[model samples]
Target: MKILIIANSKIVFGRELKEELFQKDKNIDISLLDFASLTLFDNTNQENQTYSKEFLKYKNIPKISMFFRMLYIKKVIQEYNFDIVNIHVSRWFYLLILPTLIKQKLIITFYGSDFYRTSNLIKDIQKVIYKKADAITFTNPLTMKSFLNYYNNFKDKSYVCRFGLKTLDYIDKNRDKSKTEIKQSLGYNSKKIIITCGYNSTKAQQHTKIIESIKKLDDSLLKKIQFIFPMTYGDNLNRENIKNILKSSNLDYIVLEDFLYKDENAYIKLASDIMINILETDSFSGTMQEFLYANNVVITGSWLPYELFDKEGIKYYKIDDTKELKKTITKIVNNMKEYKRDLLVNQDIIYRLSSWKNCIESWVNVY
Candidate 1:
């Protein structure tokens, strides 16, 4: 069977999935197309390497460029005649409604924002796309239900699957190091425990409000905790706003706007004592799972749909508002020993649910 996976290589999960597929079956004929660079990677060849098919980078209006890009994609699908054409992100599905794309089995996977953040017009477009899709995969049941609410006819085609955590190998490698040891090795203060605030620089992360809550903390309490905001990949304006907010406050914080290597990111999560993932919405957060695997106490927004966590018995706290974040943090700080013991129970569950070794077969079965 021939499969074509169209995804941005920058997304860690996309790269991990590509690697997992090759590892699962040596003879599997799969090609990974990085939409950003227009490069394709194939494992069927003797060299098993990537070859570039550079297209002219259009500097024109987005719509005009997008039209050409869609045409190129249509050409690729016709030329390759893949048995399955998997578009890893839902936002790009509008282009797949073209006649050539649906000839083979078409699969569209929905990440969180792509489903939640759509406008009404896009929803109408998605109605058509949903009908054309041979299969639709969602990260969690909550997201699937939300989609089914609007388009119930496609219920049979919809499936709930997760893009499992990719950082487990790195977490295993640092098993010998204590949290304090890991922090010190990474040049962090061993005395102060970490309270990570959100995962990215997106406005949905609500970094400003999180800092507002942090500002309300007692200076003495703030001194014992270091706040970390992973801003490596998102809006620059939002990153600047977060940096400015953090700079004006007396609380100790780090804004990691620069990209970090995989091992570095794993150790940071491992060193964290608490994670505040109060994003506006999410569908089975991989970051939250990674923190759970690293044994960090997680506090999430009640607005976000994470019922899967409860069903799986993954321990976590949820707040109705950002103001509640401070109180929760204070509670976790005072009762660190109890929370640590409770939160540690989540590691096994997270690993079992999220490791690619366990989850990839589901994706293969989908194909």
Candidate 2:
């Protein structure tokens, strides 16, 4: 079956779906969109193992680009014998009407932030799109429930899929570096490491508060720990603000200005000792899942959903007290082996729940 995936494969799940689906069924011809679908699409300008063809790009004005893109998109749909047009993020869900015009089955996948942070206009458009879509996919039940609350008519067509990463994908067989070696390569001499996703906006993640939390730690404790932040996507002011905080303190930290490829990101995610994923609200975080799989101690926001994590018996921290949080860190460090043993069990549970292997058949049926 020929399916045109109107989503960028740069997203971990998007890349996983494209690669895994093709691997499982060679006859299924899968193609991903080359340009923006409103999310970051480029994988460090690296050549995609799958097919990619460039289309309209912004040349200073967005309206002009959209006009040309509409013409090209419609022309492509007419020429290619696509049986299914799968839209990944709801940012462009309004464009689902285009595939319907050509009688192609339209499947819209709602990523959490797109559906969760909707404007009035998008909500109105979603009501219309939901009625027309042949199928819809969500990463978690929370996002799906949110969509249903707005427009529940398409209940039968909706499906829930989770995201996960394989350990082998991050581990370089050729390089085969140990955890210690990976840390050394990154110029991290200290054995202690804490990772925080600073690429998120201030709302999703408390960037300033997180930084201050680290600052609040004792200087002796701070000296022993290395703070690693992936801050490529934040604004300059936020970046400078973080830099100033890092500078004023004697703490050793690394702020990655450039975005890392998935493999590199996975490596860092694997190597970190602890991760802070304190967020205001979220459906599910692929990064948090990665950290859990890696068996790293993770600090998350108490406000976010944790029913699944609680059921899985995953060991996570959502404590707000800095002193108490530090004490917990000390406790974990003292009995690291037992905590790791528990994490192994949690990892197996999460793997069973999040693996793409379990969802492949359903994905095929969506088409």
Candidate 3:
């Protein structure tokens, strides 16, 4: 079957989901359609290289751009003759207003931001899209609930399908490097490494607080910990913010240079001693799942959508308590082996839950 995916961009979870689907079924032809290029201004020359202004401009653009995009989308849909058309971002729902001159099974996938932070006009557009679609896919149950609350008639078409990751069967083959060597390569030494994946945005309001907490640590404890922030998109604002924090506090750390996406990310997860998801709120964070599968100690904020821990693993910190975060770090350093053992047990459960095979199987059945 031919499936066309229309999204804001060909990056982040969109790319990951595309890769997972194609790997599972070679017979399914998958194509990505992105509207990010439609924006007139490019911020590639800015000091921080952030596209915040560009994003704002795109949102506030004259109706001409939106109409042009709808016409372009309709043209592509007609020419491709796809068996199924799935729209990934809610903003693209404007295309649904065009009459169904060519009837194809339609679906909409609701990611967190599309449901929580979008404007009322977008939500109304989504309701219309939901009415027109054959099915609706949600990344988590919380998103499904949000959609239902917004449009009561969508119950029959909505389905919850969790995101999945590609598995690594031979991850141990590259484990010969000593922790000291790995630390040296990253320009650090024997410190407890805490890694956070993805961009730094104001929407992630809790990040500044996390940095403040790190700064509050005593010199003895601070010298034993290193913070690593990796940026995936949004110019280099995330990198710059992290750099400024490190400089102001005189802390030693590493920020990775940008590289194309690859499977090596799993290895980086495995190398870290701890992973943090400090989002103000999240339906799900793929980075958190990846770290759990890698058997790393995880510290997350209290607003996590679900309880990621069972009887023996994972740690939760209150957003207001820097002291509690410091205490957790101390506990992990003093009892590393116990934490590692708990994580090893949890790894098996995480592996079964996040396998790409299972996710694709669910998707195929949904249709």
Q: Candidate 2: worst 10 consecutive residues by lDDT?
A: 37-46
- TM-score, structure 2 vs. true: 0.82
Write model 2 residue lDDT over 1-367, tens digit each, in one string. Answer: 7776666544556767776777778787776654354222222223442222334244235567665555555555566667877777765434544544338888888768677777878787666666677788887787787778777567798888665455334533313567887677666664775554444434456666676656666666666678787765535676777777778876678887766665666667667777777666677777677777776777776767766677767778776543345566556656667766666665666667666666566676666
Clashes of each: 0, 0, 1
Per-candidate TM equals 0.91, 0.82, 0.79
Cα lDDT tens digits for candidate 1, 241-309: 778877788988777766765788799888888999988877789988888788889999888888888
Task: Summarize candidate 3's per-residue lDDT along 219-331 as a digit string, tens digits.
Answer: 87667667766554444575577667667775556665554234455456656777666666667666676666666777776655654443334433333453366667667
* C-alpha lDDT values of all predictions: 0.80, 0.64, 0.61
The lDDT, on a scale of 0 to 1, for candidate 1 is 0.80
What clash pairs does model 1 have? none
For model 1 the TM-score comes to 0.91
Indicate which candidate wins on lDDT: 1
Q: What lDDT is reached at residue 321 by model 1?
A: 86
Clashing pairs in 3: 49-235
Higher-ranked by TM-score: 2 or 3: 2
